[model samples]
Target: MTLFTGLAAVAHAQGMSVSSSAFADNALLPAIHAGAGDCGGTNTSPPLEWKNLPQATRSVVIKMTDPDGAKGGGVVHWIAYNIPASVLSLPAGAGDKSGDQITVGKNVSGAAAYRGACPPVGDTPHHYVITVTATDLDPGRLPPGLDAAGLAVALAGHTLNGSTIVARYGR
Candidate 1:
């Protein structure tokens, strides 16, 4: 086999898997997880689960973004990092910023809490991409007030392998 193919196999074996019991990948999000911009849905974060991480992973980062927002630059829905490797899942509304196990970085709204999906009224369904990265960094490596871009830099070269789940929503 080609070296690239072998590497892909090994990486897949070591990669973590991310999923949500709330909705399937590419599925529409339920109202409880949606924004309340006349959409009338609660602004709660969705539940997420992960598994199959490499043993060397020290922490995990969960970032959710809307590429369809921010006039093409992409809007950050959430930027939670420093999640202990022992944590395999986050319950709904965990992003409400009530725990110390993980650090919630600043999102587009300039708040550390999760900003649920709220596409412009009558706009096409926007895709929310939730990514979970297994990394070798310590729990407090990321400083406060760091947005998703800065968070990406902090996670650079430290991420082992990760997974993503994409869900669609629009008003």
Candidate 2:
């Protein structure tokens, strides 16, 4: 089986909690892939589709972070802000563009792009949680490089709702 497929198997066996319509629950991207490094075979953003959002949702915020990252504070792999609520899906490679309506934020590597999971070889699998939040305001106002804490501060009272999808991978 391909690496992606292998990763999916692990997620399934591990009981990851994510929306069934999102990539973590889909069969296509069995694993999460990011840009850069030997572990980064592809720069795709993993297609994402969601529903059951509230009516006040003007935009959505998508973020992928490795809570079990090698470092202590965890790692941010991907962040896309100001996604119009009308948009139901983010096609693979959506993060390829810079400063688009779908803003890309800084990852763990300090770059404004996705850095896929590439744990030290032979290490245990790591869990990556991909979360989507429906906001009452536009995500465009938020600037890039705002880590989780920064994001939480900016989203103080504007968050209408949210959801999550989790996937696992390791090398």
- For candidate 1, list the clashing residue pairs, or say none: none
Please name the candidate that would achieve the greatest TM-score relative to the true structure.
1
* Candidate 2 Cα misplacement greater than 4 A, ranges: 1-35
lDDT per model vs. reference: 0.85, 0.68
Report the number of backbone clashes for model 1: 0
Query: Model 1 TM-score?
Result: 0.88
Taking the candidates one at a time, how many backbone clashes does each contain?
Answer: 0, 1
Writing each residue's lDDT as its tens digit, candidate 2 over 81-103 gives: 77787877776667644555687
